[model samples]
Target: MPQSHPASVSSRRILVAVVPPVLAAAAVLATFLSVRDRLPDRMAVHIGGGGHADGFSGQGSFLATALGVLVGDGVLFGALASWIRTNPGVQRVIAVIGGAVAVLTGWLIVAVLLANTDVADASSVTLPGVRAALAFAAAALYAAVGWLVCGKAEEAETVSGPSAGAGRLPLGDFETAGWTRVTGSRVLPVTGALVAATGIVVGFTTGWLPALPLLITGVPMALLTGARVTADRRGITVTPSLAPWPRLNVPLERIAEAGHRTVNPVRDFGGWGYRARPGASGIVLRSGDAISARLTTGSEFVVTVDDAATAAALLNTLADRERRTAAGG
Candidate 1:
């Protein structure tokens, strides 16, 4: 399969995350412009089951609020997309959801405006169930469209992974070998410092008490930005770059096989640092080369680092040796 250039891939991901919310915001604006003369000064934003107006908001406030929310959603998703590079499935999922949100929100605002068309009293406006159904239908349609445009399927078949066909390093029965790598993200420490700085600014302006949360959040993030990943006779050990207290060790007895695979922090493991969900867990830092370990217990453990293929190969060799010893014993 053809590989996309790094710049092009990043650009496409950003476009997927950004375009939907922008269109939604534009739709709100267009609707407001087209029906401004017909709509009442105050429009019914909330309608009861009977289709009568139950709550109202001023025309300007309603439009401004809708724009703000849509823009904020776009920005949030865009940031998430930029950070997550390893999983296209996650990108498509986010794009589909984002498109759906935009369509639904824009449709709702448009519905309120359309219901108020030529009505003197905001309370006299009717928002039928059909209109709500139409909005959902439109949202679902947009979601489908977004899914098609956003990306291809998830990570392709890699040369190495926790699979039966994964490659292994040749090792003699009594040989000892190991692989180690130190991986860290420049973005994390910078982010931590920025967060800490914001906390300090808050502390000086407001009260020290309110800033503690940010301080607590920032300090550890900065300290634990780097990790040392080791694979050897003992299996895999992940320890913090500067400290040893917070460490993870996957014993040789636990891992059935080891191989390399790409990992997205947000998609596979939820976020950076220690993350666990059901039968899978990882010490995820960022998206890129990662060692994937399939355990005997049917769970999987992953850790992101550089030169992961070599690490995985070594791990597989070590595990094979351990298995032979167990069988002989």
Candidate 2:
């Protein structure tokens, strides 16, 4: 007899995935209604409450916009969680990066659409608390979704094919530390630029001291944009010089360990891009997986990768060859 997968049996899995967006929609709708009554005297506004509003308050527009915001976000969060639960090896790469993108996209839409509207800031409505609640609730929903999705993905892939993930090669006996490789050189520059731009704006707004940190922080980030690993018959090479900023390099030989780690911003780290905890470090490389590696230098680096396990295996194989060569094997 065949075994039943958790996804097939657990109703909670579905509930966890479904609840957040539903709640979020309800909250936003409540906010919209509460604030609708408090429109600034000069600024004309309307709600389609009775089918008696114009363009700004058209019944269809309000409903459509609300659905777009709430349902869209809910769908994204739910789908990603589903993907993560169903896929683990892929989990090594997809969770964090994917989750962050989904989150940021959702938040960006919500913030931009609602920030200027009276509906977001009515005196009767404690907007901050509501916002906080939404954030917290969204996070909770993500966790439930991740648990269910991870389980489902793992189960589905088993029957599907050779998704063992990384094609790992054995390292000839040396203490190994887990490592993962990723590609987000694209993201590196973009993040650094945003950080730099933010610093510039804030510095000009406040004082130079606040912006000063950007100078230091920006250099490393800009440099990361140039840093990348490329594979050839010989092995992988680190190239940080390609970027316009300062650069760094590490041949495969110096690598002590590598592995793929999932960084679901919602589930694992709660957000995106470079989060560190008590014993682990992660980078939200993309939506799902991150490439993580620790070096003999006592520093661990993570980057976003499409396929973290494959990247790790490649590096591990190269590192092992270097060790064997040194041992005259």
Candidate 3:
């Protein structure tokens, strides 16, 4: 039988994931109600380049669609949070992302309505470029708030035990061993560049404000394009090859066992670059050799790289030596 998350944990996650989006949806609905009398029957809901309203919709339909999307986000993220029984790290990330997205959507919709208010001609309405920046700011602010709302990771949490494996390196007493390998996704660079290029095209066609989100997403993807995976007495560390910070370090004490496995990026991890599924999470690049580490948190952290077998062996040997030292052997 699988373990169930505590009632409090379940409620916390559900609340964090669903409540913000629901509230944002309610706010959007309220704004629609307050401004419906003033807004034109057919109003501009979509803005294109030069701040021109290209898409027009009835006020009611617009509100319905906006609210539906906001609520849909709440529902989707809520369901995802429920499926995650443990691993607060992933839960917190999800909570912040969901909340931020809801806030962004709500903020943008409100901006649209406000721009059209008291306007005699719906086609003449021009949403200020600043609204895009404002929406991004609101999302960033809500992300911080969401982070504050969720409980921190449980440092004292313990799993049943580590997975037993037989891949220890032949390290003698006082003999040191270390493994280093560079591995990355084949698709990240090209995809990120393409997205950034698209943003540039959109900026030229529309406005810089509309392209902000895409650039924000693509720039980071382009920067943190690859990973350097290393294993030593320090356990395992995976960091961006181009940067020093924002690394994942599973300390020696947290590692249960290490082994190599074949990873299917989409099938196992859903996508690339630090993905999380129910019981597992990984820095998946291409689908090939990966170092799978069973963690004390009862979750697995995988990093795909070449020469993974040797890396796993070194980790197992270090773990055995640590156990012996702790036992006063």
Candidate 4:
């Protein structure tokens, strides 16, 4: 096994961590500056439940709100980076979630300002559905950027010396070892169902046209129904408990090696549930022990599960047997 180091924030990582928040701040600043002179002297800054502006503030107050959010977010994220430098994975998760929040907040502020501009009555202005759509879009865009920019950990070490008493299971003529477990968040599905239900209700109340944006929230909820993992002679397979048609099967023949490691779901895969990085993909239901298969195709696949060491040992043992059989040794 390769020696593990305590997580430390490198200079490069600090820079990467700050980029998203800074950009989000800049976006708000740019929008405010461009529209500052055009805004009404007393802008409608607050909306009532009836979908009309209920509170008014001077243009300066409106601009101050944007500045306040920017500064507050920057301080919060910077403090998080400095304090949690030791846990790179958790830090990365915070940075990404914070960035998304910053962008969406900025978008909301800017959208409200624009929507009220040149209006005859600020109080009568209602936030359009487009703003909600834009918020979701901004979140998706920042998430992708975060995934691309987040640093990659060094390749996990593999155990290759020998398995003297590795406890191998037999599969017909081939010796095999395997494990199965259910993985995912029990709370996620319920939350998704609730959101979908809310959207449906709102859609029906306001006309079916309002439900289109619900798809964004509904699809992910449906996908979070959980998954079942199985490993054996055929390699590793991840089947979604709700939908079995789209299973992930990694053939043993394609795997060059297998090993176990302690993993952070947020840091390593950005988050949980079938995450994909540049050269790696993981069925990470949660954080902690996991088995990683280094494939001949140069990609790494991981699954979080208990007793990962035994599963990895069996995988490596089976791979060796398959290789020897192929060579007719």
Candidate 5:
């Protein structure tokens, strides 16, 4: 066999990219057809002929909704990939934004199909605000997934490229839990504040608490609980202070060298939070994975930080500082 030239390799990669998505579409269509009868009548109608302006049968509307969602998702992925081909950095932003859009689009298709009386009298089963909320939630989820896929794929390619992920940086020998230790994560507080504000609104609107009192209380609570790094002799800790639990901590000695890893939530590790891998611990974010610090003692901790490379740099710096201080003292 002859060796493939680099140009041939790039062409092959592009071909590979085009094939899988198309194969996936084919598989979906085949499965739907094979199980068409097993599916609900409304779903069948929806898929077959529900969205015609004339109004479809319940089954038709349902099927139409499903088909619409699949189509929309495909469009979302294709659009994002195309937009970010030349500028990979924009992948994360596009994925998050696109994922959110996908969700919203899915929600709307369902909502509209259900809302249309000609399709089916779905109004009785549907609640008022649920549609908007569902739409927003769906959009948010899809956009997040989009950002994750684009960003991570780009990261992997860049790392695997000729020069990027080369013989790791010269940051010296340090103990990393065979993974990355994240630092300077202070964005979580914003989430806590948002949650707290939502709680306050609900409390006030529902008369569970007076508006004036909640306004007075919520702001301070949000500020306190919002993004702050709390570190101790134990290890670095980060938590949304205002919302629920206190800070979570891990020991410093157990930390692995910090480095960024990108993962697509939709494809790679499922959704967010701590996910178990073969033998490693990692936190799944939009396009980054924070190394899981697992100590020999069996306790494990995950740090949620956006910039993995920067975070790793900070951790290395911290470790260096700690070592210097000890030697000097």
Candidate 6:
């Protein structure tokens, strides 16, 4: 296999991280120039619930807002790329976020401009399905950017091995115990709820129904505020604490081995809860100590938690006992 030079890789990473927002700005500028002559002198910048113009702004002001968003996002993502150079997963997240922001801003600018072109009232402009399409497109672009920038997962040594003695717990007849931890973040859920509420209010008051989509997007954010992990003799299970129905279960039968290691959530799983990279999926709420289970199927599942070593040890012991019992039967 051909090895990549460190400098070359770094340069590529920089380009990948920095280009999306800049391109977004450029696209916005180009679109504005194309329709500048057609826009009304004073555009209906905001609409009320009755589908009437409730707010107006000059073309320059509108342009400034769009430009500001583009520039601000570019600067933020560019800085993040530099600050998080060691973690490609986080870098990919930053790139995707930048791209999404750019796409959404550009889409909004174009939509508003197209609505106001030669039109006397902005309220008369209705985007029946276009807003949804733009949202979907933005989501698609974000995922694509993350996937492309992050590339493939490297083949790291498995977090655990088949050797029964390594970090194994002592056997006790009919002993069963478990540990549970909640990976909670104070900021994320509150922010998500607030944003969702704001979007709902905006949608109802402005008749810009596009804001209603925020409610759906915000739900995941709020749910991601915390993840609950439980490790017992059966195996390990991870679920979002806020919404626990859908869970990731790693049964003892599937676990070939288990262990704990230090990990960066951004570096390992690309920014939190129920994340999937090329080779593995994990419940990654934060960066630090985590337990990893190497499954018999060859896939790995990880979760960041406190006392990961104990969890791994218990899991290994239980799994070994299960295998031995089955063999004897």
Top candidate by TM-score:
6
User: Which window of 10 residues has the lowest lDDT sum in candidate 2?
Assistant: 44-53
Q: Which lDDT tens digits does candidate 6 get at residues 1-329?
A: 88665445544555655666677678767877898888778886665655456666788877787678678767876676666555555565666666665666566666666667778665565443556477558757765865565554243323342222338878686887787888766546775787687567545433456576778767667767777888887699888776767888888999888887776665555455567754577777777778878878787778888888888888988898889888994
Worst 10 residues of 4 by lDDT: 157-166
lDDT by residue (1-329, candidate 2, tens digit) is: 57566655333344444565576566556655655454432221221222222223333354465557457545754565455443433442344333433343244224323433664332222223344346446555665555555344334332111123435656545534333333554655776787687566434322244356766777567656433544422443444445533323455665666666655554443334455433344445345555566566555555546666766776767776778778999
TM-score of candidate 4 against the unseen true structure: 0.56
Q: Which stretches of candidate 4 lie over 4 Å from their true place?
A: 1-108, 114-120, 123-178, 186-225
Give one digit per residue, the lDDT tens place, for model 1 in 22-67.
Answer: 9888888998899999889987777765667777878888788778
> TM-score order of candidates, best first?
6, 3, 4, 1, 2, 5
What is residue 44's positional error in candidate 4, in angstroms? 6.7
Window of ten residues with lowest summed lDDT in model 5? 158-167
Candidate with best lDDT: 3
lDDT (Cα, tens digit) per residue for candidate 4, span 175-251: 44567877776545775776587566434323244455665676587568677878777888888888776798988
What is the C-alpha local distance difference test score of candidate 5? 0.42
TM-score of each: 0.55, 0.39, 0.57, 0.56, 0.31, 0.72
Model 6 spans with C-alpha error above 4 angstroms? 1-10, 13-17, 26-42, 46-61, 76-97, 114-166, 190-214
lDDT computed for candidate 1: 0.76
- Candidate 1 residue 55 Cα shift, in angstroms, is 1.8
Model 1 poorest 10 in a row by lDDT: 156-165
Q: What is the C-alpha lDDT of each candidate?
A: 0.76, 0.48, 0.77, 0.67, 0.42, 0.68
| Quality of model 3 by C-alpha lDDT | 0.77
Model 5, position 253: C-alpha lDDT score = 63
TM-score of 6: 0.72
Error of 4 at 133 (Å): 13
Query: How displaced is residue 248 in candidate 4, in Å?
Result: 0.7
Q: Candidate 1, which segments miss by more than 4 Å at Cα?
A: 1-10, 153-254, 257-264, 267-293, 296-299, 302-328
